[model samples]
Target: MPAADWWRSAVIYQVYPRSFLDSNGDGVGDLPGITAKLDYIASLGVDIVWISPFFTSPMKDFGYDVADYCDVDPLFGTLADFDALVARAHALGLKIMIDQVLSHSADNHPWFVESRASRDNPKSDWYVWAAQQADGTPPNNWLSVFGGSAWQWDARRGQYYLHNFLTSQPDLNFHQPAVQQAHLDNLRFWLERGVDGFRLDACNFHFHDRELRNNPPAALRDSTMVSSVNPYGMQAHIHDKTQPENVAFLRRIRVLLDEYQAIAIGEIGADDSLAVMGEYTTGGDKLHMAYSFNLLTSEFSAAHIRTQVEQFEARVADGWASWSVGNHDSVRVMTRWGGATPSPELAKVVLAMQLALKGTPCLYQGDELALTEADLPFEALQDPYGITFWPEFKGRDGCRTPMPWQGASAHAGFSSATPWLPVPPEHAARAVDQQAAADSPLSFARNILAWRRGVAQLGQGDIVFFDAPEPVLAFRRDLAGAPSLLAAFNLGGAALQFDWPQAAGATPLDGHGLPGAAEGAGVSLPAYGGWFALV
Candidate 1:
């Protein structure tokens, strides 16, 4: 792959800074902790390390609520620690990609603080503010993704400001040219800091309708982006987010990234996230690639996986996608998709399937260890979203538990002091030390990644799914002047023997570390097994 197109065939390993490792015994992971783990990340054979937000924040929504876009938060470390992390990551040939939350800022952010102080200040119009109605209600019916009204009344300004997430995270007014320029300047700061790329957080939420029109009721109940219990999903969200103005802003961002030969992958959470992903990445003058919440839902089926890829490929002629099944926000894939008793075989199969898709694959921190979501009591939860809606929806704290480095060490070697969240005993049993064994899922992850690097067809190929029964996903990756690579994954627990016409006369591709075999047109797969071949 060309240097500029390096991300095309790359694998991104996401480091949720708070849960990755703790170097200072602060009970929270930090930049130095990530720096110390560069070698281990490099060992995974992933090309990029997409670190989640470690920027200055008040920790309302973890680091997503940025207070200083250009500086690191003291909780994570100083800018010097971030610089050291970049240097170490580069030494290991790992490209560092940090999160850029451009849509909103912490209410305490200087800009928000200044904007909310008075209506006549220089930054007064920086945020989305509007006057209340005759009845003293919010300006509109837009609802927050967390809960309640999106509009928060600011007594100082005598107006309401929009917050799609927590009230502490105030939405930025992208309609203001100065706000746009300020964010651009912030991007330039990181670009000059020697970072390779950025993971644009809520990239589609950068713009809202200038008219501030009331959003209509949803044509259907949408549960993919927000929890079903939240009223945020009841509306179409037409006026509040995913506006067309975002396309231009994305182009502006791409131009800056092009100057540094840096790449960007946006995170899209909209009513029609796949469509927004296509819109953001189609022109190449926008995002380099984008991923959506489509795959992060609890729906795990061969049909569901096939539909997501096929739909994107059908709509996006010149765009790209970064497919991710696990992230900090959702329940761990093991528990969400793999049922009550998720096995290591399930992890291997999921990773293999994600890798075989016709896009970049992003792996979450502990998925390689087959880490199940940690079950915590209500008192132990730190996530505000969970605290608000306790029983029905438990929030993301389950997936944000500390990494288990050593099974026998105190706090699983995550920290000498007590961790912010307890490391589940189940996760401790599957720590890095134990998962390093030859037959472990971690080893399987390393082996498959290494094997994938050698296969050009798998990296650059057009995907075509075969008509297979439920619980079995079959697809072929075709590239010019090379044999087509055929893949079949058994998504369920039972061993399956299926007759696949596409696999006839295909040469079995081995060394992938999963159990499966094919003889002529007949294929056999163990529980959660995958089969690969070159035809």
Candidate 2:
């Protein structure tokens, strides 16, 4: 009955294993590479490290299409390598969390291979399979997120199988108790191996309506936000995912975590994100916390930020939220909100805002130094998702380029061999070694993160908003036991001096990483300038 201590004010750093660092000469990151970089990660003041999928995989959807849940991929290393990495991370006081794709698996997986053999196979019901329509089309009108039919015809089974993303990745039949138990066993494998918890990939998509009912079309007026951005938001998606029965499955996983005092953080990537985030984290028996893409997009105004936080607070009393402006998915924050040309100072403002919000903050790799989305040419593209969309969409390869380790070293010292994705020209200039030598962009990030940990107001406090104009965001962090803090930021590229309410008895607080002339009130932002202080 105690408060959730795992993530209350913790900072989580995400490591996309393939791009973090390369130890061997294969041009890909391995467990040893990650182990070597733990100090760099821990030095950023992050309390947890959530690594993306590195389990046995075919690497079709990168690592999202998992082949085996319990085994480590050779590309990454062996079980002993992983165990060593976990120990090294814990030595740095970092809790390790691995991504578990329980929703589906690669067709090459033995379970999937057996399930697709024939109708009479013992594993036939393990995946979502159904007879084709009279017209020889898919069973339902459900569209895949990757843009097309959700069903693939399996000639051997003589029945179409469901795939919400790629055709090779079939949807797991959560209705089967054995499937649920198998996923739980996979969780146990990691828990016993010293992993702290899991970052459940597409958590709400684990269940579906058994009747194969069509989702009700979202009300045109109600669906405006989603309809404008992507095609996946066109439908209500009620039946295809976020089923009411998902609660029972969540409880099953939560119960397992409870046994070992572990925690689970679910990624609620739903069309109605706020509502889905509420449901997934509502009760104590459900997920410990959940995150969505509400702020990961290009929305940057004060109104948009306020509406997102306020709406979630109104929905549930016991739920916890995780906020992130930049992540592995979507465009980088610098490019997404600040456009192709971003205000360097504005990046600090956004970080300040995230630190002030009432939730755990996830920092994507290279975000602290305010790394922008690297431009990659068509020939060098590696991500199929981005390649298929072509000129319309350039894929995630830009944001996923290799992490630059040194400013002048070949390939930024990530590997002696070529990397899976080429390092960007601009990224090499912001390398870790360069940042370590002097006051560089990467060092700025480390200082900010380290200073945030020392500030009580930023760690735990009630957020109070002040009346401000369009791009100016003003708020106060008030705590009864801790000193009150006043914070302000300029969202625009211009500078304008303005007077704040004088009744707050606020005094100047030292500005750590921001410029000297930008901290005080009657001050204006020089493009992304932000300041926080104890009053």
Candidate 3:
């Protein structure tokens, strides 16, 4: 029970800074732009605002590759602008959590430059570097998440450096204490700026197998393991990432955050994310919470969601879980789960299901208003990983498109000028102004978050699913003396009739215009609708 522990009941609104809003005439989002939109985001009832990396970078991997861990990118704005953003967000009672890419640094980063300059230089040990193979190939067969070899030939020292992601992102040698301390110092810089916490990127890749041993052949090393389209997960990734040493690093990070009264939420991107989430957040001393692509992928069945939440609860006993059906990395959930065109009803049902679960619900940039994947022409794609495996893999650009604020404004009012990625034309109809016309999708999202403020069982209660008929996913979230709530969802096209569990009392709140409705104890879910109760 600490101040930082407040994130347990918090609603984290993830802002893809580049696509958020642009105050300058540059078309790209900046810190001042986010500051301007503080009222809009706070109105959504989100307690925390988790900004994707706005750190200085070459932007090869957008802002994921950090060139300067402690500084803001010029394109995004200056450090002063960031401070102003933090101040404004705090003034609105919104906690600010910035993205920290500790696993790797931009290849152009000063640290990497120094580390690869000389084999025996003071900084040579900062990054992972090993000798070349006999035929001049990379030392091992480890492949980059962006494709090709994970080892990049650093001509500066006649040694190959490691990068599990893009070649421009060189993996840091966490084996070095100095490297670990340096990264911790970067965290301190933000903490000193009154930043609340961090969403650690690739949190499991902090350590590599120390021996530089080649990863053993993986079982079913096929497309099934990869993240949808990107070929990053073909290998078992045993040696390349998720090393046992990462737990210690996480503990170290937790210790650092603990000192400043901050919390850490890790992005555990692995095929076995459940197990990793179990490991990365083993105790209260590690990550406060961790999220994965388990729910983010296109899988939308009630059974699938039940299994995922149950598996984590059974396996990750001591850890907190975070769920997001949509993010910048994958196609929007509306298109991924809902058939053909976007289904706002299904989207609301999915969001309700997420909020009903016993965990923090993180909303992606545009998921609230039922945003679908924008069609980004290959010519306009900026993600190198997507470009490398083009046509079949369209990259994450579609999901990272600009947020539409106004229905008719140029660039959807996301910017005064042309935006970095064009706003989808279809997005105009679902714009904030359009949806906020009355108590609509946008309003429901706000209602759910606000309603969450009074419900403790909905956030951290022990969940027990009732044996309801197919398509009607019903469950009870119990927190001892607190009233156990019944959550029923209709995932099918036809209305689902469910016999709700006998709880103390039930009150229906379907006026929000979302999916699902409740009529006393017997409720009928209107095709892809849901109902949440305070029993």
Candidate 4:
């Protein structure tokens, strides 16, 4: 692969900084913790390590609400710690990608502080501020993704400021040229720090309609269709996000990335995410790759996966996609897709399916261990979203628990001090040390990733779905002048048999570590099983 195209078929591992490891015994993971584990990350055969935000913050929304865009938080470490991390990761042949939360900043951010100070301030226009209606209501029908109205009354400015997420995270006014320039300058600061790329958080929320038109009511309220916990999805979201000006801003971001030979993958959350993803990346002057919430939902059927991938392929002809099944914000794939009790067989199948697809794959930390979502009592829950919703929604704390590195050690070797979130007892037995055994899922995951790297057809090939019965997801991956590979999986809980005519001349590829049996006539997959063949 060309240097500029390294991300095209890359397998990127997402390291949620706070849960990865703790080096300072502060009960929270930090930059030095990540640096200490660089070799382990590289051993997974991933090309990039996408570290979640560690910037200075009030921790209201963790590091997403950045108080200082250009500095590392003292909680994580200082600037020197970050530089050491970059140096160590590069030494191990791993590219470092940091999260850039450009959509909003912590209310304590100097820009937000000054902008909210007074209407006449020079930075007053840097944030999205609007006046209330005669009735004292918000200017429009915009709703926050967290809960309630998106507008918050700022007494200092005597106006309502927009916050797409938490009220403490005030939205930036990208409509203002100065705001856009300042954000670009922030990116330039990181580029000068030798970062390889950026994971653009909430990339679509950069611009809202200047008119602040009322969003029309949504026609449906399906959880699978939109976020289930919050009513933010109850509106059409037409005016509040996915604005046309976002494309031009992405072009500006792309130009800056090009100057440093870096790459960017955008996180797009929208009502029509596929369409927005196509628009954001189709021109190549926008995001290098973009991923939506299509695969992060509760749906686990083969048909759903096929539709998401096919729709993206159709809509974004020239665009690219980066696929993920689990992240910091969602429940673990094992508990969501698999049963309450995590199954190693099911985990293997899911990993195979994600890697076999025709896009860049992202592996969340602890996913290789087949870790299930930690079951925490209400008092143990620290996520504000869950605390607010309580029983109806558990929030993201289940997925953000500390990683288990040693099964027998206290706190699972995550920290000497008490961990911010207790490590689940179920995950302790599946720690890195235990999973290093030959037959463990962690070993299987490493083998699968290494095998994927060797097969150019699997990594960079075009994907074509086969006409298989329900519960059976069969696809053929083909590249010009390379041997095509046939990959199939049983996503359901029952045994399945399928006659794949296209695999007539194919031979089973060993060392894939997937369960099931393959024969000359056809292949039989057990519950949550997979089969791969080189044709």
Would you estimate the TM-scores of all the predictions?
0.99, 0.94, 0.95, 0.98
Where model 1 places Cα greater than 4 Å from the true spot, the runs are none
Worst ten in a row by lDDT for model 1? 1-10
Q: Model 2 — TM-score against the truth?
A: 0.94
What candidate 3 gets wrong by more than 4 Å, as runs, is: 1-4, 221-231, 499-522
Model 1 over residues 1-535: C-alpha lDDT tens digits?
5667778899999999999888888899999999998999999999999999998889989999999999899999999999999999998999999999999999999998899889999998899999999999998899999999999998988999999999999999999999999999999999999999999999888999988899999999888988888888899989999998888898999999999999999999998888888988997799999999999999999999999999999889889999999999999999999777887788999999999999999999999999998889999999999999888999999999999999999889999899999999988999999886888989999999999999887788999999888899999999899989999999999998899988788899899988999967788998988999998
Ranking 3 against 4 by lDDT, winner: 4
TM-score of 4: 0.98
Point out where model 2 deviates above 4 Å.
Answer: 1-6, 220-230, 437-439, 515-526
The best candidate in terms of lDDT: 1
Off by over 4 Å in 4: 222-226
lDDT of each: 0.92, 0.81, 0.83, 0.90
lDDT of 2 by residue, 322-344 (tens): 88787777678888888887755
Ranking of candidates on TM-score, top first? 1, 4, 3, 2
The residue pairs found clashing in candidate 3 are 515-529, 515-530, 516-529, 516-530
Local accuracy of candidate 3 as per-residue lDDT tens digits, 1-535: 3455688878889999999999888989988989999999999988889999998999999999988888899999999999999999999999999999999999899988888778888988999999898999889888887778888887779989999888888999999999989988899999999999999988888889888888766565444234545545556778888988777878888888988889888888776888888777767888999998888767677888888888898887678888878788888888888867756777777788888887888999888888888888989999897898888878889999999999899888998888899998988778898896455678788887777777777766888877777777888888877777777888777876777645335865444445555655678778877777767
Where does the lowest 10-residue lDDT sum fall in candidate 3?
A: 221-230
- Per-residue error for 125 in candidate 2, Å, reads 1.1
Which stretch of 10 consecutive residues in model 2 shows the poorest summed lDDT? 221-230
